[model samples]
Target: MKKENLRQTSEKVWGACALAVKAHALAKKGARLESHRDLWVYKNEIAREIGDWVKIVFKLADSMHKNFYENLTTREDVLKE
Candidate 1:
């Protein structure tokens, strides 16, 4: 693989990992919020929103990975002469 392509792949992988970690942190926060009755309703709502956001983030990460693999597979076909 070309150096630029390798670099791009590495960046994408790192970005995905970072996003996953963020999602995990948000999930933990959401769970913590659920433990407090005074803030339960509001916090639960926020947690639900965070859950949705995490799903979207993971979907984006999945797309990035899929695109990276597709690009790798078709590198020769897709590259400019």
Candidate 2:
């Protein structure tokens, strides 16, 4: 793999990890807010936000892995700057 590709993959993995941590924290708070109606609404909003972030992280990870494998087979770097 090219150095650039490796660096990009590292950055993406780091970003995904950070997002996961944030989502986990939000989920914890959301769980805690389950009993209060007003707080539950806020918790639901936070849950939705966490879902969106998880989707983004999954997309990024999937794209990166797919491109990495494709590059391995085709020797063509697909992640353009």
Candidate 3:
């Protein structure tokens, strides 16, 4: 994908991750969460509590966010899975 499109797509992924983290934190602590990293860090618990697929999706979203800035993800990498 083009860099501009990648950025836009990554932003949308980041937004979804932020919302997911917010809902997770609110459910667990009744407070707001700051980072998408939390989801990956707690993937085991998330998988056990939510589902394995949720954890995988969160990880993918985080990767997309990182890729936007680092420019390390290729279209083939995205399409691989």
Candidate 4:
């Protein structure tokens, strides 16, 4: 059981890291958003209110990567994000 729990934890952490990487790729390749101002650039280029949430996803991915390394985030905290 302990081994299984460790495996699950490891998998979750890796998944979070992957998510962060993918988000970065999307921002860099899809929108070319490299800096904070670039976020606005993407938003303006799209001209859609819903595109704002794309920024949130990028931020959340970053937070998840940090939380994964620190091991300070709970499953509930991630779910809320």
TM-score of each: 0.36, 0.33, 0.65, 0.42
lDDT-best of 3 and 4? 3
Q: Which candidate tops lDDT?
A: 3
**Comparing 2 and 4 on TM-score, the stronger one:** 4
Q: What is the lDDT of residue 72 in candidate 3?
A: 79
For residues 1-81, could you state the per-residue lDDT of candidate 4 as single tens digits? 244343346446546644544465487566344554454355444435446665566556556656646766666666666
Model 2 alpha-carbon drift over 4 Å, by segment: 7-49, 72-81
Candidate 2 lDDT trough over 10 residues, lowest sum: 72-81
Give per-residue CA lDDT, model 3, range 1-81, as digits (tens). Answer: 456476557657766876876777678768655654565565556578878897778778778778778877666655452
Give model 4's TM-score versus the native structure.
0.42
Best to worst by TM-score, what's the order? 3, 4, 1, 2
Please give the CA lDDT of all the candidate structures: 0.46, 0.47, 0.68, 0.53
Model 1 has an lDDT value of: 0.46
lDDT of 3 at 20: 73
Query: CA lDDT of 54 in candidate 4?
Result: 57
Superposed Cα RMSD, model 1: 10.1
lDDT of 3: 0.68
User: Which candidate leads the pack in TM-score?
Assistant: 3
- Which pairs in model 4 have colliding backbones? none
- Residue 78, model 3: lDDT of 54
